[model samples]
Target: MLLCSLVAIIPLLYSVDAEQSLSANGKVLELDESNFDLAISAFDFILVDFYAPWCGHCKRLSPQLDEAAPTLSSLKEPIVIAKVNADKFTRLARKYDIDGFPTLKVFMHGVPVEYKGPRKADLLVRYLKKFVAPDVSVLDSDSAISNFVEASGPHFPIFIGFGLNESMISKLAEKYKKKAWFSVAKDFSEDIMVSYDFDKVPALVSLHPSYNEQSIFYGPFEVEFLEDFIKQNLFPLVLPINQDTLKTLKDDERKIVLTFVEDETEESSKKIIKLLKAAASANRDLVFGYVGIKQWEDFTETFEANKKTPLPKMVIWDGDEEYFSVIGSERIDEEDQATQISRFLEGYKEGKTIKKRISGPSFLGFINSLIGIRTVYMIVFIVAVVMIIQTINKDDEEPPGVGTREQGDNASSSVSEAESKEYRSGEKED
Candidate 1:
């Protein structure tokens, strides 16, 4: 009887293991405290969604995750998608600091980083593909180059070196791998040069597809020059001013010579940007960025730019709350825009500018919220309401119509108890 029982138990265990293996193959695995560690350990790259069922965003995101799971799992090195009911598994939520519902984190070798990409299935797949891609992809043909660029999508900058040795870029490629896509083209035609608009061999071309911009550098490919070119091209010649774009500037120490126009689509604004681009290329020491009052009125107004102040205005921003405006070059007229910009630069260099603070919090401060600020505020409000209700219930439970002195003592005791409970609650949260 003992031998028969052992034989049956072995088969049962094998079947359980097989079921788990199949579940992880191409489906979104449902995980909890018990199996969360095992699941993360099993996959090199796993995207885990810590969600609460009652969250509307989580409910909507569920189907997108299901749709993306199979495609991601079918890759050369599969990426597993898993979800945890963080509300039910309080320990897991606490460990990951899941303050908001439907928090997505991509775990690489058991290290977690918050996922701030798109939520749709297709965009999410493209975004996550960046994490798994090789640091430097080698392209042997024009078609391969095209295919690689297409697969890379338009989210990050792309650096492709033609007729250049792989060893030349391998180090910088690995160093800046997370911020940009690096690749080498082993063979290509002169038509390719004309296509990418480079006239020389051993040339490095940087493409910002989203911005419809490209830059090329030929020769002097020493390590320092190459690295400097790569760093400069990480941002487009004239960067656009937006929340996402501003986040990219946090690490860049260069101050922004920013221009504000009434509307970016206007012919005058387009002309202004063209002039700005010329200045940007000549003066790579300063970053050139532009914002349209029509596009981002709130941001533009922070610099004191308005329809009445001047249609085309300029400022030098420290990527924070403070900006400096040139005394005489604050406004650019239509007839003499180029000369005015030159004067503005000269004035800035001569210390002919006034320093002022932005009206509100810096853009980077708002972008630092792991989840959206509205969601964080909502969570705080809900917790405060619950604590208030609990305190009221405790007060109601007190015995009615005690002696005056006794009632006062009871009230003090109740207040003290509430304060202690609140402090303990904060401690546990921390």
Candidate 2:
């Protein structure tokens, strides 16, 4: 009976373990070191989550992945959601340089691309849908180009490669598909090319239909050149400073002039933006951005800005040097703000203004420096010595009752003598 019971419990435990290994939706593939390469080769588009069992974020992401797996698997060109336990499979983790847990990488044709978008299920599914279509669509006619531009939503920029092979720009298109729409036209009319002032084959043009702005790059279809061209022209003259834009500005080696305004709708903020636009246009070397102090309270705290520091205040941040400077003794207004910014720029270039280092809270360090550690110890010792001396002096003083009894006796004797004298005088008078 005992042997039979042990056999029954072992099979039940195995069944439970098998069920736990499957995804919540039961559609995702579970891969390990033995079959990772085989599965990567099998699937055209696979999203792999490199995770550790001990990671809290990985546990949170597991449910989302399971929920999204079935929907993604049902697509016409399905995407496979697979995962590897990085802690268990050390070799695979090291191969991918998996430094962080819950890292998502999208594999296309066995090549891995890091997925940097949001981690939610809906967002991940939407981003994966891009891989279902070709990276670069071919536009056969002029109307097709216009229709494509009109069909693409207003926010995304459009890139059209004229007389270039599909293979020439496919990789670039795939890399930046989230940022912009990419298309190629093989037999584009010379007239269209001339309109954009393109004089060579393999020419590329980036168009912003909403703003009626276009940029032309004539030669060098190399990845580096095209990337730089797109980056320089993709954004507006002034950018909003967020984590993404801040990294881009730092990578571009551009000094930032960050304006802290009260609110976006204020008249002063509007004027400051206009002035910043003019300044950015004139000084392409500097990146300009503005933050509303009310909206982003933490940003002001990070920069140590407060009510004492006036709003519509501009500060220059040198990303390379990791220091910042503020304008001295002058208020910036709509009329003279541009002049003041230009002067500030000139002063920065000539090293005339003071710069504060970017550092964490140093209140303790400041106090320590104001009064040296040795001086603090010395002061404490002196205070302790004075207190000890005062306590000793207090102990040495006499108590109040030491002579009170004798004084009372003397007073009693004097009273008795005075009574006797009064009695003798009365007897003599009788």
Candidate 3:
């Protein structure tokens, strides 16, 4: 329902990847030596049913899994259903205490939660239901989404970004029936554009996927490239949530600044407080925040499940370990330093909760890329269709391979006398 478009990319060397196997209903993911490390970090849950193709129990379970594949993905982040050849991952099977033919284990947020036995579809579905996040409840997403679209506008609203540094088009919103119509923002500001897929920040092109994206700016770009990208790759989108809603008192009139303070200890927290107080007093409209990697887990847990907001991770890794070394063993914030942050962010319009309906077009685009777009799929489908048509057009083109009235009488008599040892080798088996 959340627009899942699992894609598979087979290597030229014929290596099979479980994540890629998620491309279709019948294929299950396989975790091997090469990608096991990266696979662990890729998702929230993984339900691995390690089994073999020959075993009857495994055979029953395999088809059953395919039937329920569509439902299993309802988790906030769907579990990767990995199918390993015990012969291939023999050590892996023994590591987890699996001795049977069909063993299923559920992993939650990258940690193994529990194991359940071979069961029928109904029981398996019921058991598998417990491991996913509450927000990702299974339901008929297609019907619900179609109904939702009907309730929305007939107009397919599209917005284009114009310049180098992107500006909030909301700054240019127009008045309609006593309300402002949404704006089309243009980015013409900085020289660089940022995206998630690239190892570094800038590139020839960047992709911001929708696996967990609620809203997307993906670009803090300049106008020309922004306009070029819009016309080429992306569909028209309704920019629902604007900058005025994300933060308070942002003004391009002054330089909008961001700096990551290395505050690991309480003493450093104190120093940061002092620094912010001085900066805020000197420049009334600058934005600042701290990113503490040590506290990231707890910070992200609620933000992810309850608020449905993505976690903001820090660039620094050893914040907790080097806290004292970095900040001189002191807390951030003196009395007045703590006071201002509380007052500013509390009722600020930028941090205020927005209860409006979120736009879905951007997410749909991401889904299409993941599941719908592929040259290989098109070629395969076209070939199948052509084969079917050729079979039909052959109608009476020639005699049916083995036996046909169209063949000459001498040929038919000769075939009968050969005792069909040749015909048996070439014929389709019942």
Q: Summarize candidate 2's per-residue lDDT along 262-374 as a digit string, tens digits.
A: 77668878777877777776676677787776765555545655556666666777754355664462346556777887786776777666677644353333233334333
Least well predicted 10-residue stretch by lDDT in candidate 1 = 421-430
Greater-lDDT candidate between 1 and 3? 1
Candidate 3 structure, TM-score to reference: 0.27
Task: Write down the RMSD of all candidates, one decimal each.
Answer: 7.2, 22.2, 27.1
List residue ranges in candidate 1 displaced over 4 A: 1-23, 50-60, 85-103, 265-267, 305-309, 361-430
The residue ranges of model 3 lying beyond 4 angstroms of the native Cα positions read 1-27, 74-76, 134-430
Task: Sort every candidate by TM-score, greatest first.
Answer: 1, 2, 3
Error of 3 at 379 (Å): 54
**Best of the candidates, TM-score:** 1
**Cα shift from native, residue 44, model 2 (Å):** 3.5
What overall lDDT goes with each candidate model?
0.81, 0.68, 0.38
lDDT, residue 184, candidate 3:
24
| Model 2 quality (TM-score) | 0.57
How far residue 235's Cα lies from its native spot in candidate 3, in Å, is 54
TM per candidate: 0.75, 0.57, 0.27
Assess candidate 3 and give its lDDT.
0.38
